[model samples]
Target: MSNINDKIRQIAKETEPELIHIRRELHQYPELGIDLPKTHEIISRELHKIPGLKIREHAAGGYGLIAELKGKKEHGKNVLLRADIDALPLEEKMESTYKSRHDGRMHACGHDGHATWLIGAAKILAQLTDEFGGCIRFAFQPGEEVGLGADTMIEEDKVLEDPKMDMAFAAHGWPSVESGKIGIVRRYAFGCVGDFKVRIIGKKGHASWPEQTIDPIAAANEIYQHIPAILTRTISGTEPKIMSVTYMQAGDVNVRNIIPQDCVFGGTMRAVKREVLEKMKTELEKEIKGICQVYGTSYQADIRIHGGSVKNAPELLNGVKKSVADVLGKENVYIIEEDNLGGENFAEYSCRVPAVYMFIGIKPEEKEAIPGLHSPEYQFDDTVLAGAAAAFANIAIHGCMGELKEN
Candidate 1:
């Protein structure tokens, strides 16, 4: 391993106590969406303690904070490190000293850990600026759940400007991999995401006369049944795509006897590429249109595109992977074979610059079932904090100083 990475690992270990304190505090008082007032305050307070960090508050026109640290040497390449600080709408289900105090907010997606390790990396890199020759911008953003935080930071706050970020990077906590390890994706790691709502319109009538009503429930049931085949039967077999109807309903529970005037159903669609996702969405509406026509009902389709996939720079993978392997042993760095359908706002950064997003494992070796992201029971492994911090710092060190060298 490189000597610079060794020092980063050491500093990260020494900074664990502070990392845990900040993580716990942020986890306890979780806030949601772009307007994270308390989250902003806690992150800003800890970042201000680090020397050489020029803190930029309200980077997203909300509570987003970006901390920039420059090297003592001549300017080289500019790198951006990002962490989403928003929480989910779920209530914390796990018991701990740092469980969320807020009733309806939770850090179920592990952004608290992301923020902590980023801060820890800042503290570590601040000490070793003499080894590198560029500026590192630590972007602590909000509203990742709504998929607007990264856009606001880039377009509104000009996060990619000022220094003109040459490369960007971030990591996600994934339970699919073992704890104390890391996972690197060679290509696209996340798929394009789109949400949709379909409202089946019909006429209401008494239960005694089935022919008198348009029967929206019947049309809705048919639409629900056709959802899975919308992508499988329509899109090409070569293209990886999926459509899942997460929710559907119609009529009041109090009056079950009368037929409802209309029924509504909604779900999400994903594809390996953005064009494929759009095709799936269009096919879905076409399928719904045909199904509703057969049932003698009109329908409304409301589809909202979230964002694009996370595309890792093909040329930069080996270099960043080597940097991560330097911090954590090479044996601990695993390659992810498949891309996930989950959405991420970080694609906003990947679209404009050379970017790579890795995954830090949080799966426990014990017998209990592992919780997935966005679940109320999801727990982030604190043991990965030091390694994650070291990995982030090492990426910056090697990327700016040793970028041209072969791994």
Candidate 2:
């Protein structure tokens, strides 16, 4: 075990230059959503440089690459390490040499860093094939930002079809924690995401004639006012849940003298448990309809199940906690007791096998960390790359070694 850790550290040190270049290249050319053609091309080219990698591309949606490193002993477990390869639709705000060249799009979530780490791991694993057994699959996924990439990868049967993946692991770059630290939340890591679009229909009339019109704006206001109460009553305090109205569109702006005939509202709901989320949805719908009925108006709500909550496997998490502590030190690792409402595509892999989702610290030392992920100012410290790569390699080797019993 000591020898493996030392080797991982050495490999990370040796690959630092390449990793930097890969991240910068990815940073300069950012692609949005599932259509990552240029990004896929770069990944394909790099992985092909390795000796024994089997790669495949998805016919629809985006590209998914599978690189297999065959083992010598054949007694070890088959494991997988995945990294998402999509960028967000936000203009780059930093003044760095590797800023995004694409307009209105950037790799704000540190996915470029994630992809670089996985590639670095693959290179190391390929070089040290004699020490490990079974196979390690590298999944370069697409569309994580829009919340459909993992499902697309799964529907294509990319990971499940591979006989080598007995378990899987992945990580995300976290901006709140300082560089060289790691955060591991074992129980409930992230919340399920649900999107709702509501439409209210009412009769239009002159503003002066209040009795002649059933005002949709008034009904929407009522529905909005009742949301806080609904959340408080329907969702328990022990469970983490939040509902917010993000977008609203009403009648044309030019006609202030006339009441609008209809109004549209859209928002999201997040929770740690699926059943609880469903209950909240039902209650919200019923309440909205009832309120509309009272106001003599009709309403429609469209709720879409976007992403499921991230539930880390207990055993995998234990392994991760130990591995991260081993590399980053025990004091730097924090185990969060509660679930976060943020959605991650990594949850899709958790459904198939034992998986661990972790956050690698990228907070700057001087200024307060950039705003949370997806914000315009969000940026990760490149120095965290060494710790992140080492931690990921440690988790991969430990997971494939099958030393820890399932919890």
Candidate 3:
């Protein structure tokens, strides 16, 4: 075990420079959505450089790629390591040399680092095929920013079957923890995501008239105010839920003297549990309808479930914790007790197999204030990529060697 750890560390160290280079290159040419031809080209070229990896590509649903490394010792069963390859539709704010070259497109969520780490781990695992058994499937997914990556990959590519996965693993960079640290949680690592759109219909009239019109704006305001208060009374305080009204439109911007007949609004809701999330959705729809009724208005709604919460399998987590601690000392590893409301498409894979989604700390040492993920100013220290690479390699070997219980 110690010898394998030493080899993993050595290879990670040797590949650290290349990992950083690849991350920077990816950052420079950030692409949005699933049709990332250039990003696919770059990733495929790198994967081909590693010997004995069977590569598969998907272009219909998304720019998905899966590279399989057949083990020398074991042949049938497999393990999956996934990385998101899509970026956000925001412009880069950082003035770094590797800043996004594509206008209004950025890899602000650390996916650039995630993709590079998987590539580095794939190289190490591919080289030392004799060390462990079972196949290692490295999945580079697309459309994660808008949240269709994992489902599309699974449906279009059938990623979980054929060589069927025994266990799976993935990681993301986190700024809340200090750089180079690893955070693991046994349950509810990420929240379920739900997107909702509400349209309030009312009669339009002149601004001077008070009782002559049914104002949808008034109903929307009431719905907005009651949403938070109602959730506080209904949802348990222990469970963290976030409901945000991200977009709203009422009347024409140029005309202020008249009330528009329609008021349209949309937002996102997140909860740590699937049942709790569904409850939130039901409550929200009911509340909106009730408010519209009072205002003598009609309302329509569209509430769609994006992704479910991610829970790490307890038995697999124990083995993964030992592996991570073996690779990056126990002091650098942390067991997170609190659940994060952030949504991850990796939840799709975690729900399918005994999976571990780790958080790699990437906060810069010199900065007192760390930038949040998905923000235009978000950035992280590139040095954590090596440790991340080594830790993932450790999990791929150690996690598959042990017997895992199905979820």
Top-lDDT structure, candidate number: 1
lDDT (tens digit, per residue) of candidate 2 on 71-90: 67667888888898888999
RMSD of each: 1.6, 1.7, 1.9
Off by over 4 Å in 2: 58-61
Q: How big is the positional error of residue 91 in model 1, measured in Å on the Cα after superposition? A: 1.8
| Each prediction's number of clashing residue pairs | 0, 0, 0
Best-matching candidate per TM-score: 1
Per-candidate TM-scores read 0.96, 0.95, 0.95
- TM for candidate 2 is 0.95
Task: Assess candidate 1 and give its TM-score to the true structure.
Answer: 0.96
Off by over 4 Å in 3: 59-62, 74-77, 403-407
User: Per-residue CA lDDT of candidate 1, range 127-192, in tens?
Assistant: 998988888999998989877688889998899999898889999998888888888887787778
Query: How are the candidates ranked when ordered by lDDT, highest leading?
Result: 1, 3, 2
